[model samples]
Target: MDLIRDDDENNSISANPPEGYVEPGWPALYSALHQDPQYLYQPYAIWRFTLYWTLLFYGFVFLVTGLLLLLNFTKRHPRLALLSFALWILSSLLLGLISSTIVAYALAALYNAAFLRMSTWVPPLWGAVQVLLLIFSAAANVPFFTG
Candidate 1:
């Protein structure tokens, strides 16, 4: 979806005019009436981008952890090991609240799948933590069902 505006169709949402005057300066309410559409208009794209960031952060933790584990297998790099572990925990704590709850949940699910597939998969602990965070985020997203 274009963040700008469509050059094709004009916005048609309007109330009947009082007598014969055009309703002036209500373009803010009818955003597409002008030449720019607001961020909210592209819900799916906005959500996807936010989710990508959250997933990217989470995946970075797993990637770093896996690298550290590979180093441990070869020899020892205590400083790098500690730093990677710390970052993994921080990523877990921050991913969910960084954006929309639904986006966060989507990212967690994506991260889990990728982590599970790596040949030297990161340890399972981070994935478990992400699952729990996803539960919390999903609950937060559930509105009062009108059903």
Candidate 2:
């Protein structure tokens, strides 16, 4: 299988190359993974939905924990409180990591599709977006912080 090369002389481009000769890039990958290029939108939509629900769960937990703490729920049920705290921290951390991973995968999928153009800047921009979201999620509890 021969890879397609850009012919400068002809100034023409082949968007869909023949099968078995998958180009060593996102375009080829996108074509291979999806039967219809429009399906490329699915992963990103799912990623966003997951992030939204995860954040919502975190906010609900924070509120419930804070309210119970006011009534000295921890002192009454020390073990339960400790367990809840531990679980909340671990789950949130795990979810964040997983969310970032899914986002990265979605970005790769986008690259394979025609939605995102190939560029060196993509990696850094993606990293920055992930970092910013993590920071925002972490800071969501600031208003309830006793300290």
TM-scores for every candidate against the unseen true structure: 0.27, 0.34
TM-score for candidate 2, please give it. Answer: 0.34
Which 10-residue span in candidate 2 carries the lowest summed lDDT?
A: 21-30
Most accurate candidate by TM-score:
2
lDDT of 2: 0.50
In model 2, the Cα lDDT at residue 26 comes to 26
**lDDT per residue (tens digit) for residues 104-129 in model 1:** 34544554333321111121223445
Instruction: Tell me the tens digit of each residue's lDDT in model 2 across 1-147.
Output: 754343546432244332343223222223435542322223443344335444455445554655565446577788877777767666665765576567656775655454333333343355456656766776786887536
Clashes by residue pair, model 1: none
Highest lDDT: give the candidate number. 2
Question: What residue runs in model 2 are displaced by over 4 Å at the alpha carbon?
Answer: 1-72, 115-147
